[model samples]
Structures are given as C-alpha cells and as structure tokens.
Target: MEFREDILGAPYEAAELTLRPDDEGAVCATLVRRLVPGSERAVLYVHGYNDYFFQTNLADHYTALGFSFYALDLRKYGRSLRPHQSPNFVRHLAEYDEEIDEAVRIIRELDGHRQLLLNGHSTGGLIAALWAGRRAGRAVVDGLFLNSPFLSMPAGPAVRTVGGPAVTAIGRMAPTRVLPSSLNPHYTHSLHKDHQGEWDFDLTLKPAEGFPLYAGWLAAIHQGHRRLRSGLGIDVPVLLMASTRSISTTVWNEGLRRADAVLRADDIAAQGPRLGRHVTIVRIEDGIHDLVLSGEAARTRVFAELDHWLAAYLDVPAIEAPLIDAPLIDARPADARPAGESA
Candidate 1:
C-alpha cells in the first residue's frame, strides 16, 4: 500500500489496496487520507452509493477538530472502479469486510493512531453499522457516526416483505440482472455545481443518473437490512444523524435543497436505537440526505451536534461547543422498535 498524491491533490494522499479477485476478475479499494500533524485520533469515512471520497470540506472539518481523516472508495465504485468490472456489484454486504479490515489495520496498526472513529453516509452508514455490530466488543472502533443511514427501505412494509424474497431469488439466478431504478436525479442536481448545488465533484464517477441497480446488489442490501433489524448488538457509542424530513418528488423543487431527497428520516429515526444502547439519534432540520452537504445553517447545526456528542461520548474536549439548538431534534423516536423486533 504505497501512498501517492490523490486526485484531490496536495495534502491529500491516496493508496490503492489490492484484494482477492472475485467473479469480476480483479478487485481493489482506494484509501484516501489527509493527516493532521501530531493528531492522536483518526476518522475513517465511507461514502454512499453512487459516490466517492471527494468531500474535502468534510476532511477539513475533521482536521480542524484535531483528528486525521481518511475516506474509502470501495471496490467497483469511484477510484476503485475497473474497466472490466460491473459498477458497484456485490453478492453480499459482508464482502466489504476485506477492504474495511485492511483499512482499519493500516489506520490503527501501521499509522499508530490511538483512537478511531468510523463515519458513513447513506448506504455507507448501513455498512458501517453492520460492520461495527459484527465487530462488537472488539474495541477496534471507538465511536460510530452515521449521516442519514439507509436502515430501512423507503417503501412501505408490504412492498419490502413481498419483494425481498423475489429479489433474492432473482439475484441468485441472475446476479447481474439490472433492476429499474427510481433514484431521483434531483438529489444529484441538488449537490453538483452544474445544477442547483454548490459542490464540484466528478460527475462521471457520481453521475446525475446513477449507475444501474443490480438484482444481486439489492438482494445483498436487503440481507443487510434484515441482519441489522435482527440486531448485531453494537456496544460502542453511536451518533446517528438524518434530515428532519424527506422530500420525494419527480420534478425539480427548491425543497430538495433543504430536505433529504433519498432515504426517509422517519425510517432512520425509528431504527436508530436498534444500533446499540448508547446510540444518539439527531434530526437536523433543513438537512439533506448527506447531512454534511446540507445548506450553511443546517451544516453548522450538523457539525455542532456532532461536536457536542463527541465531547460527551468520545472524550473530545469541547471548544466552547454550544448546546444543541431547538431546530435539532435529539431524541429517540417514541415508537422505536426493540433490538430483535422485525421492522
């Protein structure tokens, strides 16, 4: 794992990690890092589906908080995508373990970081929670931060129940079969500079119309959701943040900029407690699906909530971090299901 200057350029370095080949022939994941001098703690971030490690502002925020930052572009996505591979295809969510384990080893053992925090957004959030749960009591990670984790499907329970087995069976028979995508392009428009948003990332890597959704991939995600719903007993402190509401629309609307355009915040809040006993669920008003990418006022609240939580839970000294404002809802849902209950 030799580090080289990343596509993001100076001060941000990237390393290519070779993993055991899968049905796709060869596989790899990229680890991008920006180290803060003499920082004892580090953060490992995983981006959502159709996304990569391009949030330099996020890295800047962590570095400002005195922690080194790293991001992973998982196999078949972003920097790790290869010419011969199907975009973002995986038979099982557990397949991610290989790269995640390697990244953790490099961060903790090779880099000599004393404390580690795992941060994930959207689908990455679900992956992080499941990974943390599987490694519960291992102490490999000190804290978990989820930004609008896709814990449950956006559809009603009936649709999930009826479609789950069908998708799995179809996935088994034709793993690469493409499924019709309902991914809202407005979300992409809401984030990219060419549209209504302010960020400038590689559109080819995270296209306005995302990569095809595969049956096998959806099946794997369903399996992961089931496992999470059944409970993995993650024992570490977990900070789960999501938008206060989700806006689902076919046409472009200004509201898309202020609310989550992907996963539902209600679903995320409902499943927050299932993560662990020490979970802290925060709802940021006017926050987008990726809380960090929200508008200025909302992003400020998101970071403030994170800072307050970290100060209380991770032993990070609070630099006069103010109490959470009223716009931020910092409570578990009243009807939160038990750890082992079916969602």
Candidate 2:
C-alpha cells in the first residue's frame, strides 16, 4: 500500500527514494532530509529488523549538532516497501552492501557532505559495524554510532555453537523459506499504539511477523559475528550504546522497558573493541531496547551521554539534546526535524 498518514502510521510524510544497484535491479528506499541544505558532515541512519525510519526528530538530533541528518527506510521497510518483498529478508546480511553503498552515494553525492556518519539500531547496528569494517568505510565516514546493537547471537551456548551452525547451513539451501515463529510477543507492548514512545509507525512494515529467519540471513549474521569477533582493521572510531542490562525477548515484564530486551548488552560491551581501533562503549542504565526511544527519564540520560560524548570527540559544542519538541512534520503523535544545515 502507499505510504500515507493512515497507511504507514508515521509522524511525518516520508520521502521515497530508489537505490538502484550497479549490478542488480533498483531497491525501494526513503530519505528523511532531502529538501534541506546540509553541512560537510551528514549522518545516514539505518534501522533495525522489522523496522523503518519514522522519527523525524531523530533527524533533528544531528542537525542540532550542526551536522545534516539523513535516514534511510531501507528496502522492504517503511516507504521502501514492495508488494512481493518480505518486510525484511535476506540470505546473507552482506547482500545489504548495495543498499548501504547506494544510500551513502546518494547522501554524499546529493548533499555533497565530506564526512558520513553511519548510525544504526539493533540489526542495523550489526550491519553498520560490518560495513564500517569494509574498505569503503575507510574513506567514507568519520565515525559510527550503534544504538542497542546486536553483536553476538543471543542464544544459549549450545544453540550458538552447534544449533546455529546447523540451522544456518540448512538456511542457505532454502533461502526464501521461513523459520517457525520468528516474532516474539513479550516486547510488543513496549512499542504498541498506547506506548509512551514518540514514534507511530505501521506495524505491518515494522512487523510485530517476528521477521523471517531464513538460512541466508542467519548465516550472514554469523559471518558478521565472526568478522567482528576476529577483529576488524577499521581506521575510524566507533561508538556503541546499549542498555545497562538485557532481558529475554520471550520473557514479558517491566524489565523489558528498563533494559534491552533483545541482545545482550555485555556481549556488545565486550566485543565492540574488536570492531575497530577507536571504540567507545556507553551503557545506559534503565534504557530500553532502543535507547533513544526509551522512557522520558531514560531519554534524558541517553541525550546527555550523546551530547557529552559528541562534544568531547567530534569537537562539537554542547547543543540542546534531541527531543520530540520541534515543529510537527506530520500527523503522528509528536516528531520534529532539526532546522537548517550545510551544503
């Protein structure tokens, strides 16, 4: 269906873009800050599994820091949806290189920004890390920021070791096939309609579907884990943000609101160093699955840390932290896009 106020349940009208692969067909996509001019630096944000970019105020977060912000609703999600494609599906996560490269190409070329900050959440975090480990990332961006990113698999030791390998191998032979029960309901209330969060995205695109778990996707994630755990030779710096704790996706409780109820924060805190030379790890106590989208008090902490860290490292002066207080861009609850920018 079309990405309308009623259809996508967004806080703003999403602008559509097509990322055509040099080697394959064009993929559907979306860019958040196309109309505004930008600075030498820009952030290209990628969303996690069963997700898309909907929060415009998130764009303002960077813009307020004097950097232009650009977020992509990657293929098969948000405004990029296709009738035939799954919400989020792939045999290998590396296959996303096309979308990543093209998205950067669009931002860098169109906005002509010199520095590209690749920001992501959840699975998108893993994708960003893997991409930054590549040669392109060496020359493309200045840094990376991952929010509640999924690094190592969250399964138990036995499943992670034996079960993962066996299941992944079976997946390659049957890429399009679905694994049973990909969705976990325990965390659903955290993002439901009555939730306290600031976004109002469509559940269909974001899938409340469990996201199909085919063999290729599992193998791709495992490959990323191997590469990251083995140590990536990236030259740029990386910032990883996670909740102070973790809760299982299967266990429903208030703890899910206060901690990352998906991936293990300790694993990320531990493995982040292997991703590159310059790595900074920040843990948000009582943060939710997506730190930025956590409760009010939690968000305050999230922005404080972000502001302090960005100033100390990027040399950016302290500006107002990101909040949902700017002008309304659409019909959803509350969202804003930061004011003017460079280029």
Candidate 3:
C-alpha cells in the first residue's frame, strides 16, 4: 500500500489496498488519512451508502481533539470502485472484514496508535457495530461511535418482516438483480453546494439519486439488522447520535435541511442500546441525517455533546471552549438486555 496525496489535497493522503475478489472480479478498498504526528489515539471513519470520506472538517475536528483521523471507502465504493465492479455491492456485510482488518493493521501496527475509535455513519454505522461485536472480548477497538446508524428500515417494521424473507430468497437465486432505489435526492440537495447546501463533494462518487440497490445487498442489510435486534454483545463503550425527528419524503422542502431524510430517528434511538452494555444515546434537535452536516446551531450542539461524552466516558480531555451553550437534547444510558428483542 503506497499513500499519495488524495483528491482532497494536502494533509490528506489515500492508500488503496488490494483484496481477494469475488464473482464480480478484482476488489479494493481505500484508506484515507490525515495523521497528527505523534498522536497515540486515532479514529477510523466509515462512510454510509452512496458516501465517501470527503468530510475534511470531520477529520479536522478529531485532529483538534488530538487524534490521527482515517476514513475507509470499502470495496466497490468511492475511491475503490473500478469499472468492472458493482457500486457498493456486497452479498454479506462480513465481506467488508478484509479491508477493515487491513485498515486496523495499518493504523495500529504501522502507525503505532495505541487507542483507536471506530466511527461510522448510517449503513457504515451498522457495519461498524456488527464488526465490533464480532471482535468482542478482543482489544481491537477501544470505542464505537455511530452517527445516525441505520438500525431499522425507514419503511417501518412490518415491511421488513414481510419483505426480508422474499429479498433473501431472490438474493440467493439471483444476487445481481437490481431493485428499484428508494433514495431521495433531497438529502443530497441538502448537502451538496451546487444544490442548497454548503459542502462540495464529487457527485460522481456520491450521486444525487444514488446507485441501484441490489436484492442481495438489501438482504445483507436486513440480516445485519436482524443480528442487531438479536444482540451482538459488542464489548466497548458506544456513542450513538441522531436527529430528534425524521422526515421521509421525496419532494424538496426546507425541512429536509434540518431533519433526517433517510432512516427513522426513533428507530435508531430505540435500536441503539442493543449494541452493547455501555452505550450513550444523544439526540440533536434540528440536525439532519448526518449530524456533522447539520446547520450551524444544531451542528454546534452535536459537537458539544460529542466532546463532553468523550471526556466523560472515553477519558479524552475536553476542549476548553464548549461548542454549544444550550442544554443538551438528551443523554441517557441504554438498558441493555443480554439478548435483544425484535423491533
């Protein structure tokens, strides 16, 4: 793996790792880094569906709090996508173990970071939680941080109950069959600069309409959710953050900018405790699906809550100036069950 200046430019570098290929052909994953020299702690960020590591400000925030930051674009994603491969397609979520394991090796063995935090967003968050659970009782990761994890289907539980089996059956027979996408463009509109937002990222990497969702991929996600509902026994402190409200709609509206337009926030909050014995849930009012991409006021509150939580639970020193002066929206411990019940 050779690291070179990334598309994001100076201070940011990306390295590509070759992985064992599946039926679709050659595979690779990209690890992007912004190292803070001599820092002993690091953060490994995983992007959600139709997303990549383009959040420079997020890296900066971690670096400010004394950590080397790294983000992974899993196989067939952003920097790793090749013409021969399907976009973000995996028959089983465990297929990501190849690159995530490599990334951990590089961060801990090569870079020599002693403490590592696993940070993930949306679908990536689900992957991270399950991955951590699989690594339970091992000291691979120090903590887990999830930003709006896709713990439950946005269409609600009934659809998942009835459709999961059908999707899995179709996936087993024809894994490559594409399903109609349910992604709304308004969420993209709320984030991209060309639209109504302030951030500018490569649209090709994270298209407004998103790529096709395969039956196999959806089936894999359903399986992951099932595993979460049954409990994963993740043995680490966890921090789960999301907006207080969810707004699911296809049409563009001002509310899309301030609320979660993807997964349901209530479902996320309800499912978060199932992750581990020690989990903290925080709800940010007026925040979008990605708390980091929320408006200024809400974003500040999100960061403030994060900073305080890190200092309180993970032993990280708090910043001198708090990001927000308002009362925190919510901070509660999850009553974890040995085995979780169905949603």
Best by TM-score: 1
Model 1 TM-score is: 0.95
Sort the candidates on TM-score, descending order.
1, 3, 2
Deviation from native of the Cα of residue 49 in model 1, angstroms:
0.6
lDDT of 3 by residue, 1-343 (tens): 8999999998999998999989988899999999999999999999999999898888889999999999999999899999998899999999998899999999999999999999999999999999999999989999998999988888746888898899999988888899999898989989999999999999999999999888889889989998999998999899999887889777889999889999888778888879989999988889999899899888888778888888987799989986665555543323332346321
- How much does each candidate deviate from the true structure in C-alpha RMSD? 3.4, 9.9, 3.9
Where does candidate 2 stray beyond 4 Å? 1-26, 34-38, 195-198, 249-251, 320-343
User: Deviation in angstroms for 337 in model 1?
Assistant: 13
Which should have the higher TM-score, number 1 or number 3?
A: 1
List model 2 lDDT by residue over 244-274, tens digit each: 6778756557777788777777766777778
CA lDDT of 288 in candidate 3? 96
Which ten-residue region of model 3 has the weakest summed lDDT? 330-339
Clashes of each: 0, 9, 0
Question: How well does each candidate superpose onto the true structure, as a TM-score?
Answer: 0.95, 0.83, 0.95
Colliding pairs, model 1 = none
Q: Global lDDT for candidate 3?
A: 0.90
